[model samples]
Target: SADYQKILKDGGFVISMSGKGNCYDNAMVETVFKTLKAEIIWRTIFLSRLEAEIAIGRYIDGFYNPVRRHSALGYRSPCDFEAAA
Candidate 1:
């Protein structure tokens, strides 16, 4: 628990997996994964796992990180949010 305490003291943010008893804790993350699965992974049949990897990599590096507007970040793309900071 020392590392957890140190992280808390340093104001470091960490994501934790939901405990089996705590459904609410993973709700948002689960929702996002549901969206990802529904919209991207489940929608198409790829020739191989490598193709899926490339598609997701490109989605994150080329589109999602730099261009997609996130409502939680005041509707700014992650790159825009970091640039302002």
Candidate 2:
């Protein structure tokens, strides 16, 4: 934990806490960012900002929502999870 804090400090990332009662503030947003960096940003080299934007849009519409496997949903995509429900 100390090493993580040191890395954040070196990176100039200021860690902030949620309000006292709102326990889930930014949790989902952080998870999405982590997944996006791992699955797309780290793997791709785009020629332009517009190209990267389009690719991210496509990834969200074409894969992440309807097709990407969610382990918490028994490894099913959102579409399949909804269908089963």
Candidate 3:
């Protein structure tokens, strides 16, 4: 299909594993998803989809991007790591 072919071409320079069922292949990403679900989704029951969207947006952009410390990035937030670089 054109979509599949185009995706392959577009991702020529990217390092991504093809297919699924390989948990160890994307460990860091899986960990982040798990943490988000545990901290945000499981902790609160949103009355509306829009409310949940807004809350997640704020959590990631306002809190996670600037203040959340990541072990992979030398215990610094993504914003701090980027600023240092």
Q: How close is candidate 3 to the true structure, as a TM-score?
A: 0.81
The ten-residue window of minimal lDDT in model 1 covers: 12-21
- Report, for every candidate in turn, its global Cα lDDT versus the true structure: 0.80, 0.90, 0.88
The ten-residue window of minimal lDDT in model 3 covers 13-22
lDDT of each residue in 1-85, candidate 2, tens digit only: 7899889989999977767777479777778899999999999999999999999999988999899998878999878999999
Task: Give me the overall lDDT of model 1.
Answer: 0.80
- Model 3 per-residue lDDT tens digits across residues 15-61: 45667687888888898889789889899999999999999888899
Q: What's the count of clashing pairs in each model shown? A: 0, 0, 0
Best by TM-score: 3
Ranking by lDDT: 2, 3, 1
TM-score to true structure, per model: 0.64, 0.63, 0.81
Model 1, span 1-85: residue lDDT tens:
7788678768965645555789788776776677667867888788999999998888778877798887878999889999999
